[model samples]
Target chain A: MHFGIISTGPISAEFSQAIKFTDGADISAVFSRNAESAQAFIDQQQLQATAFDSVEALCASNDVDAVYIASPNSLHLSHALVAIQAGKHVVIEKPAVWNPAQWDQVWGAAEKHKVLVFEAARHIYEPAQKIVRDYLVGKKPKTVRLNFSQYSSRWDAVEAGEEPNIFSLKTGGGALVDLGVYPIYDAIYWFGEPDGVRYFPALAPTGVDGAGTLVLVYKDFNVIITIAKNAHSDAPSEILLGRETLRLSSVQGIDLVTEYTAGDEQVLFDSKATPGSRPLSELMRFEAEFFCDMIQAHLEGNFDEARVNRYRSLTLLSRSVNEVCTNARYTAGIFFENETLEISG
Target chain B: MHFGIISTGPISAEFSQAIKFTDGADISAVFSRNAESAQAFIDQQQLQATAFDSVEALCASNDVDAVYIASPNSLHLSHALVAIQAGKHVVIEKPAVWNPAQWDQVWGAAEKHKVLVFEAARHIYEPAQKIVRDYLVGKKPKTVRLNFSQYSSRWDAVEAGEEPNIFSLKTGGGALVDLGVYPIYDAIYWFGEPDGVRYFPALAPTGVDGAGTLVLVYKDFNVIITIAKNAHSDAPSEILLGRETLRLSSVQGIDLVTEYTAGDEQVLFDSKATPGSRPLSELMRFEAEFFCDMIQAHLEGNFDEARVNRYRSLTLLSRSVNEVCTNARYTAGIFFENETLEISG
Candidate 1:
């Protein structure tokens, strides 16, 4: 898989580094608004890939098999449409978009072009996710407390009276769209859709969520999600079953996961490396491998019903998470500048 | 100070045993609807205490100076009033009362009798509470996540199709009233009154909350409280400061507390005694000593304005927590029987 990295950012750099750890995936190209920045990223990473100043040029490159979209969040739909229209697969960053309507446009274009699209929620592809799912096979869980709070590295810029994209509402960015997506994906993919949702965000000085608590109401239980971009939670995320529990280091890149039943606790996954789980590049490798495998399956064309169902489920889960997160954020008075300027949007 | 135990339940037994750890406090009387039960409790603990079948007899006896009201939740106000009206100081269990109105009645009676009233929020009296409070003295915390979930011992009876008082709505029982009050008190006592509050309870079969998430919204932060009676949480409660964190073993009986600042992690308070703390009785001893000290202060009427201020602050905190917990629970559709029959009540 030859991937064309979209936008020269730290996340795109992570994607490039992650691709190196995969079996048969590599960065074939890079894109940035500034040609110098694109070339600088290419040089910094010492990649043999071409650097394109335009999304169209990167998407049209014959060497590129797919486009990894790490552009500013509000521009995802527009950038994704360019890639999909040019017959390239797409992997959008954490949130597909600010809302489902925008995601539908990108996803519809992918289906029309007979290509696959994945929201790069790398944590869900972690082995701990399967362990957590298997741990709850015959068991019913009542409450799940999922948290992904990291004090943003760019917060220093904000403190100096500057608005980084991650803390600015104009870029469709906030704690919910940034850190909250990990747990939102975990909750939806594991427990299915909630009956209702409510979010109470601690809005930042720049009119974005610095931190927040979201309650996903189910029939018998509530999944509480805590997320932040200006503060960090040292405690691990956990699911409280009737007589059991599953604990994850965090909702993102879970390197340590434990299951407890009665008087016993079993460590399901413990990487024993990196204080905050396997390094981001190493953990992100799983998503790269998964996406490459899916692309291979599409190229192979002759697949069984079970394979089709897996792909369908993954895409649906992605869409559902985007919708749930966007709607939940709207309830907390968080709004994006694109698609809808409506207050209660 | 001589104390009377109201109700022969587990909490009453704890209160009686806890007195043994205090400097000058002991259970001198026991009250129960069944005389045999009261006698059995006194006998089981091997305490030199009188057994009375009625609240009137126990409260009116000169053998008791204060009444430790550990009766069923809904009966707390009535029992406390009986003791207070008899000129006996009172130490009611966690909630004090279901609502502020009910608490007002007990408090008023105590004021008229010139006797002290205290909520047995033992956790706050733990040395760890002072450590956490002092740690956040000059710092601003944007989030505090408090969890006190214990898989209820009485849940087995609920599973056996019996509505134990802790799981019975008729008894003003639920996770909020039973377990949630600990975190509620921790939040209010440490952070003062929240600007607003909301609770999302996981209602049990008997219309009581089995587990729940309560959000106490401060101006710049949200105190997220997680509590359960039908399940357990192994994760510790934590305060998310920008560059520092304080982790408690749980929101209650914090045996271990660690503070992390920059690269240095400090063990602020570790009892080196018990896993969950110096046993419940040992922790409860703090409240016993505090109440006893307060009683002595009142007796020595030559006290300064600071002493009066401390008493006023403690009483106001008790009332504020009662009001906050009651209002928050009502939002989650939990209600007690003794209070107004209003649907939202």
Candidate 2:
């Protein structure tokens, strides 16, 4: 399938490169707010795709089969709606939209147009999920702790008086939406919606979260999601079940998953092919490939049962995550008018 | 200092063993509700002391200079008061009292009688405190996370229909008081008191917190304290100050303290004297010795400055921790009638 890229950000480049590993996906068009940036991105990537000066033109392109929205958080709804209304499948970056209203609107449009809309939360497709599933085959988790914290390189630039977009509350940028969403999505995927949610955010001077810890209370187990942009955590994320534990070295990008039982450590999943092989630098490609397969399966109509299940799961997960984020933000007293949008069926 | 033992439980034996390492402290009396249990304990430890049938009898014994109350949580206030009224200094086991009112009452009695009251929380006297202090010299912490979770050995017995005191809500037996207090004390010692506190507890079938996570919000940083009696956590507790982090391998015992800076780990303090020694079991003796020295200094009127500082610090910590615990319990909606006690000035 041919893919259209939106925005000329670093993530778009990563997505474009990752498309190389997919079975049936290629970048056919690129979109940027300005013509110069679009032309530059095309030239830099050495792609045969046409450069579109506007998202409307990109959505109008007949050469593109699906559009990948990598725009800022604030623009996700607008960009995704345009693509979906144009009868094009859409692959949105993590945090497809800030609030449930936008989520419902986007999905409503996608359903009306009968197009697939995928949230690009790649961790769900990683081998770590399979490892966790296999580990918890018969057992039950008592508690799950997920942490994804790193001192962003952009933080130094922002500290040096540069206004990075990520530090701007106006752009729907905050540690919770930007980084915390990963662990939130992981929890939603693994445990479904929580019974209750609470957030403790360290809001930056820009009125955005610089760091935060979120507790998602489940019936049998509690999930603690810790995320930060101004600091780092070296401790691995963990899932405790009685005396057994499943550990992921990095929650942000899980490269290794280990299980500890009876005081013995066993590696369940490793991104590396061999002990001495070059580390997997293009891990994001796994999600891209998975999305491509999902899109292909959905379009071909060969596996209706599997396709329906995937759609239902994805829709439920997206709605649950968006709702949890909304509740947490409100509870923390960091009110965003749009973020207060209630979940709608 | 000759000590009178209150209650002949497992902790009493542990305390008796630990008292052997103290400079001038000895178990001079053993107290139990029944004379048979007290005599058995005395015989087992081979103590050259009397076995009193009642706390009142032990308190009246001139051979005892201080009383170490190792009774159940419900009886700490009354036991300590008896010792205080008898002109004996007191060392009460942790969760010294469930509520601030009980704490104030015990301290008021001790003050009125001109006797010292100590809460025997062993972690405070460990080398971990000095290591953290040295590491954070002139620096402010951005965030601190402390976890102390262990699968209780008594869980099986409790599940088998045994009403172990640690699992009884009527006796103020719960993870928050039994195990959570360790990390709470750590937070109070390191950060003084937080501006706000919240707890999310997973209550057991007995109506006590089986496991829980507490968030203490300070002005510049927040502390996350996780404690469990139903499971275990292998993640090292961390104190983050900018890019530097001080890690404790075990928050409850802190066998090793490591500092990480710029991607390097340095072992700041290790309980092991040699590289491969047996690792200093019965480390609880250090706290007992510290208490013995404090009691000796206070009684002899020596080391006035050090004694005063230590006393003042311990009092402040105990009060702050009790206050935080009260607020957290209320916020979590686990209302205990005793937990609603106001902090006395």
Candidate 3:
């Protein structure tokens, strides 16, 4: 399989590397809004791929089989739509869109084009998260608490008066949209849509959430989502099952995951590999693998429950998070940079 | 000091044992509405304190210096008011009252009678809690997550057709009112009243909350509260500060509080004691000792800032929790057994 990369940002560069390193896929070409950024990608890495100034030219290149939309959050929907319209498979970063309506449009385009559309939510592919799901198989789970809070350096930039894209509402920035969505996916992927939802968010000066908490109430269990960007936490990026708890010490990578039972029992399932790989690249690799497997299943005329589940789950998960952030902003009386004007959007 | 037992229930029995085992206070008498219940307490304990048929007689007794109100949740207010009016200090178990208005009345009465009113929130008095708070003094605190969920046998009975008084809405029974208040207290005590609050409660068939989640937002921090009475979890009761995190394996007792810090640091603050002393009872002892110290300060006509801080903090904490629960019940259409009855004395 051949993959084209978009944006040439740091994330895109890493994803390009992961594709180059992976067994099944080759980095075919790289595109950037600026020719200089694309040329820099080639010069720095000494890559064989063609550098294109526009996405359309890159999509037209016969060498590319799929396009990876590694652009800013705000551009996910439009970029993916363009790629899907060009009859190419698409893998976009998490938070498929800024809001649900955009996601609906993207989904419609994907269905119309008959091409794979994947949201890169890496934890779903993590072995430890699967362990958490498997642990809940027999027991009648009654409650869940999922926490993934990593204080970002970009938040410090936002605090220092520079408005990074991650802190701008226009770019789908906020702790909820960026960080809390991880736990949201965990909850929905594991437990399905909650009967009800409630959210509380702490906003940056730009009105984007610096931190937030969301509670999803299901019929038999309640899941809590805690996320933050402004401050540090030692929260086990974990899923708390009723009988046993499956936990990861860090969201960046799983060094250790432990399971515990009622009588102070312990089961240590630690992945002893050193943290040498780039986390973002690992996530991109996992996304590509899932996409390849999913597309293969689709080609075989098989309805893969896991693949379809991922699609529907990410759709609803992103939608639900957007609603929570909107509710939080309304309750907090927050106004974003884009709120003051339509800005031809 | 002489202590009069307020109820003959199992909790009251435990209270009597705790007081007996406690260092400073002595059980002078036991009070119950029924003669059989009072006699059972006498038979079981082999105590010299005579049984009283009513709370009024116990309060009026010259031998009783303080009253421990361990009655049904609904009866806390009436019993507390009576004991305070009788010039005896009062130690009321949690859910202190149905509402803050009742709390206000009790506080007013206690002030007029020159007696102290204390809620037996033993977690506040625990050594582990103290250690955590002391550690946060110089550190720039950021986030806190408190979870105290345990499946109760009483709730199982409540769910199975019986409207146990503990599950009775009129009696202040529910997840938010019963178990959720602890996390709320922990948050407000540690961080202070939130700038905003959001609650998501899981309402049971009886209209009582089986479980709930609350997110308290401070200016630059967040506190996530997850609690339940109809579930089980091994998720450590956790507090996330900026510099480090203090995690307890069990929220119910003080054992080993593991502190994990930045740069791969780990410190164990173990207060493991011998078999003669239990963590929960040790908290009760601390509460008693604190009360003794407060009384001494009162006799000296000196206002103790620490005691005043605790009272003010608790009052604010309970008020904030009550506000959120009341709003949530209205929004969720939660019904208690006596919910239809006008909430009045």
Task: Please report the candidate that would top TM-score against the real structure.
Answer: 1
Kindly list the per-residue Cα lDDT of model 3 for residues B49-154, writing each as its tens digit.
8789888889999988888898888888899988988888888887687655667888889879988777877667767777767766766555678777766778
Q: After superposing candidate 3 on the true structure, give the runs of residues whose Cα lies further than 4 Å from its correct spot.
A: A20-24, A33-47, A127-140, A219-221, A237-259, A264-280, A294-345, B17-24, B33-48, B137-141, B238-260, B264-269, B273-279, B295-340
Candidate 2 Cα RMSD after full superposition onto the native fold (Å): 3.2
Q: Kindly list the per-residue Cα lDDT of model 2 for residues A196-296, writing each as its tens digit.
A: 89898887766777788899998866888888787767788888876677888776567678888545888888877432132332667778877788788
Ranking by lDDT: 1, 2, 3
lDDT score of model 2? Answer: 0.80
Per-residue lDDT of candidate 3, residues A306-343 (tens digit): 77887666556656655554554545554444543432
**Model 3 clash tally, residue pairs:** 0
What's the C-alpha lDDT at position A28 in model 1? 87
lDDT of 3 at A295: 60
> Model 3 chain B — which ten-residue stretch has the worst lDDT?
B274-283
Off by over 4 Å in 2: A157-163, A273-281, A301-303, A335-345, B160-162, B273-281, B335-345
Q: What is the C-alpha RMSD of each candidate to the true structure, in Å?
A: 2.5, 3.2, 4.2
Candidate 3 vs. true structure, TM-score: 0.85
- Cα deviation at B159, candidate 2, in Å, is 3.6
**Clashing residue pairs, backbone N/CA/C < 3 A, model 1:** none
Q: Give the Cα-based TM-score of candidate 2 against the true structure.
A: 0.93
- Real contacts recovered, all predictions: 0.63, 0.24, 0.37
Give interface RMSD, per candidate: 1.7, 1.7, 2.7
